[model samples]
Target: MAAVSLTAVPARADGPRPAVLVLPGGGYGHQADHEAEPVAEWLASLGIHAYVLRYRVAPHRHPAPLEDAKMAMLQIRSESSGPAVDPTRVGVLGFSAGGHLAATLSTAVATGNAALDVQAAVPDLTVLCYPVVSCTEDVHQGSVDNLLGASPSDDLLREVSADLHVTAATPPAFVWHTADDAAVPVHHSLAYTGSLIRAGVPAELHVFPHGRHGLGLATGDPGPDQWTSLCAAWLTRRGWTQSSPSVM
Candidate 1:
């Protein structure tokens, strides 16, 4: 079973608070540490309930990771889930391969399981950081191999290529990548953001000139660190955060 580590804030007297599920990148083989807890803490600092999902990785394959994400989303939105969060305000933030998973969840349809409410599993917003968005061009080979096996067919590749799945129903997104990201390439974000725009979903993309891939929060790095502030401001505009962007 996937484990969810919660970092919750006090319930607001106004109404249910917004919540976010953090998914760390590890190329679908493991979860990255830096992208997990610290990211959740930052969201919690903004007065939003945050949960870090350690979803299944390699040896699990395709639907397994996606299923775990869906289950986590459902758990977060459930009335009895222990937090006073607005079900309609749930979102996701993912990095690297985890960002691919987040995009998949945002664009995928329900699995036809009567027990799982599709609406509950879908995110209202999405944040992708240095994400792997394609299985074809500029593909992250390790992630593709782990999630779909070493020999994924063309049909399957298209199926998992997140940028190819965007629709009008896809959630609005905020995505950022370094222009020189050699690992996954900035084209991934460009393709996904373009698809979102074509689908009429609100989206934001930022390509930094420097910084290597997997710079979670880019803590000490001045240039890339601006993503946090920009994202916080985006969240505020979307009414997910009450804090001023400057504080981030």
Candidate 2:
């Protein structure tokens, strides 16, 4: 089973708070350290309960990581105590390969599994940072290889390619990437956002003029660091977080 660490805020007097499941990127080989706890704490600081999911990586293939993510979503929705999280307000935030996983969850349809509540596995909203959204063109080869093995079939690739799976039912998303990201490329984010627009799903996209791939919070750097503030405001507008006088 995957381990999930929680960073929860105190219960609000008004009602249950929104929560997010954070997934760190590592090309599906390992979870990135900077993207995990720090991101979770940031979400908590915004008055949202957050959980960092240490999902299974390489040596584990397709469905393993997805299954872990699904399980984590279910756990968050099922929690009745400890943290006052509203089950209906659950969302997901991921980076790189983790973003692929988050998008997968958002676009997934009912699996007809007897034990799993398919709807519960989907996020109410999604945030993808420097994500690997496609498995066909402009693909992150390492993430594709790690998640689906090196010789994944064309059909399997299409199945996991999130851009190809977007529907009107898919959750709204906020996506960001740098225009010059050599590793994953900005096309991944562009492709996904285009599909979202075509599907009539509310989507927001940001393409920074500069920055490399995997700039988790993009701290210190003046250019890409604005994504956090932008995302925070987006969350506030969506009612996921309280509107504050200033954003961190």
Candidate 3:
């Protein structure tokens, strides 16, 4: 099983708290420190349980990471009725390549088998930060090569590109990208957002004027720092926050 570090606060007096599965992007090379524990801590501070998944990458490839993502979702859902979490409210958030993984889960359908379906591991909601949504032209080459290998087949490429797979059944998404990101172009998010809209799935997207790729939390970057606050508000709007709906 993939390693999952749980960050859970005490259960609220009212009921089970909502939770998020956080995936940090590293171009399928490794997980980012800034995007991992820091994000979990922030969510926990808001009374929402968080799980940081140290999913396999690089040498592992494709379905391997996806499988890990599914496992984490299954584990969280398994304890949904427990005091620790609200199964139905579980969601996912990812940065860059991790965003691609999260998007894959959002669009992936259940296979109808208990073990394989794993109770249909799709997240109730998704947040993609500068995600590499395409395996084609808009792709992040390093991430594509790492995940799908060099010279992947056209069919395989199409199959893995999360944007091409969106459907009305896919969960709503909140996506953000900086226009100046050279590594993973902003168009990736734009195209994915367009697909979501065409499929009638609820989606929100923000395109900032400047910021580089992999700027997790964009701490000191004034423009990108707003993303955190905006995302918090978006979460609140969906009632995913542990406390009453209010922007953090």
TM-score of every candidate: 0.91, 0.92, 0.90
What are the clashing pairs of model 1?
Answer: none
Candidate 2 off by > 4 Å: 1-14, 109-114, 243-248
Each candidate's clash count:
0, 0, 0
Clashing pairs in 2: none
Candidate 1 TM-score to native: 0.91
Of candidate 3, the 10-residue stretch with the lowest lDDT total is: 4-13
> Candidate 3 clashing pairs?
none
**Compared with the true structure, what per-residue lDDT tens digits does model 1 show for residues 173-238?**
999999998898999999999999999999999999998999999988878999999998899988
Which 10-residue window of candidate 2 scores lowest in summed lDDT? Answer: 4-13
**Candidate 2 per-residue lDDT over residues 35-67, each given as its tens digit:** 998998888888888888888888888877887
- TM-score winner, 1 or 2: 2
Q: Give the TM-score of candidate 3.
A: 0.90
RMSD of each: 3.3, 3.2, 3.2
